[model samples]
Target: MLAFAGAGLWLLLAGPADVLGIDSGNAGMVLLMTATWTALYQVGRLPPEDVVRVGSPAEWKAWIGTAFMAAAIAYFLTRGEVLAGVTVFNDPHAQRIGRNLVLLLVAWSVLSSVMASRWKGVVEQDERDREIAAQASGWGRGALVAVVIGLAVLLGLSPASRLAWASHLMIANLLIFALMWSCFVEYAATAAYYWRERRWQ
Candidate 1:
């Protein structure tokens, strides 16, 4: 939960406007995207032994298609402009690309889950996956600790700076970047762990 705590501290210090760079409506949508993406990934990652029948290949295909469509909707509404130039078609095309990428990721996750579940025998535990996850967790925690200490030291050194408001906002963004980066590192580490475990066995 340190990641969440750090994010919270960042938000408290920086406020949503400075970090998110949008009005409340858009900011809320960004939050929604983050939640939706994470949820989609989790839902697509059910263990093989769950024995729920999962559905046929056709059903899986439909689910993937639906995920892509949902992503498309989200991309156009939010991140589409991120890729734009001053030109006319730039924004729309960028939105399409962003949507397509989201769809690809969703499709890949579903497809991988389906393939893993198709194995005829018992699924073995992957040791490398465990190690990677452990490392990721360590890094994430370390980031949080370092951030808190740094903020404390900075504040103690110059309490007057906090009144400037920008100081806190800067700290907030740093915390956000740290938390996001740590989370990403952990995810990569976890994926690597699984790959290595599969390889070693």
Candidate 2:
């Protein structure tokens, strides 16, 4: 709850100015502070029951992967565009999104580390977990391959003279989106497997 609130507050305070290219320096600092505070609060204070409910190693991995990938997708979706000869970090909106994404990843890492430290010996992965992970990984790899092939075909078929069709930045973003989508699918599949296992047991 506190984590969510922190993220919402950060977005509310920094999102508009970032998108509009105003107050970049202070906005970045505010975002960092909010993220640090949120991460510490969540890591040190979240209930043990809530952490335990995350289940085995596989489930924990799935949850963390899903979260980070979801954040990445959100960041990329909100990031306006990359201009020629301009670094992504130079753009205010992109920098804001990047910072938020990094914050999310850091927060999740902190949470996961805390949970693992507290539950050290109890979170072992059984054969079932290994099997589910293998299956999920295969599905993720397949999805990634399919997406890459599709994108290659689309780009290859497009007319060279069309600016929108041939934008390197767009294509790069699409590839990143495809990768993130694959990761999300993998984590979702792993979570489903864990749910099914629990349901049957």
Candidate 3:
């Protein structure tokens, strides 16, 4: 939910609507993504377990790939030309990564759900899995909170002249980075736990 909504808003805020090339149905797609977000969020504010489908530890490890892919798409589309030297890409300030991020999140969510459901009724996960998840989630969320607080302090204490790059669009990017960083931390931690615990068997 956060992934989809945040990404969609990330693009829409870069709007004048026209700058997004919305005449090609990207606008409808963003609207659809937002509507889906609203619907999911409105469903009684469901518990995380109810909404987040879990698969085997191996499957969870695979999700790290999804997070990395989303991050790559965000970079290549928004700022790839910076390294690639192609005039076809023109997001110097990274105001457009959200469009790609939204698509990647939605696609990855659907794919992960379908994959997770393959284990339905068989009950693959055990208490150990849950323990790792709890621990990993704490690592992820704690890292996110700490980074956001650090950013707040940096922005608050720094002289305005030194912080001129922190525009509204850039702040949006920072929020996006924070979320992505958390997911990376969580997924990587989960994978690491599984790998380390495998020696116990």
The regions of model 2 sitting more than 4 angstroms off are: 2-15, 18-54, 80-96, 106-111, 163-166
- Tell me each candidate's TM-score: 0.34, 0.68, 0.59
Off by more than 4 A, model 3? 1-95
Which lDDT tens digits does candidate 2 get at residues 81-185? 432223443565555455665665566676667556755656467788889999999889988999999888877886766546345655665776788789888
Which prediction has the highest lDDT against the true structure?
A: 2
User: Among these predicted structures, which one has the highest TM-score?
Assistant: 2
Q: Considering lDDT, which of the candidate structures 1 and 2 is the better prediction for this target?
A: 2
Q: Note the clash tally of each candidate.
A: 2, 0, 0
Ranked by TM-score, the better of candidates 1 and 3 is: 3
Off by over 4 Å in 1: 1-125, 159-162, 166-182, 191-201
Clashing pairs in 1: 128-193, 129-193
lDDT of 2 at 154: 77
By lDDT, the candidates rank as: 2, 3, 1
Residue 98 CA displacement from its true place in model 3, Å? 1.9
lDDT of each: 0.46, 0.65, 0.58
**lDDT (0-100) at residue 116 of candidate 3?**
55
Candidates sorted by TM-score, descending order? Answer: 2, 3, 1
What is the Cα-based TM-score of model 3? 0.59
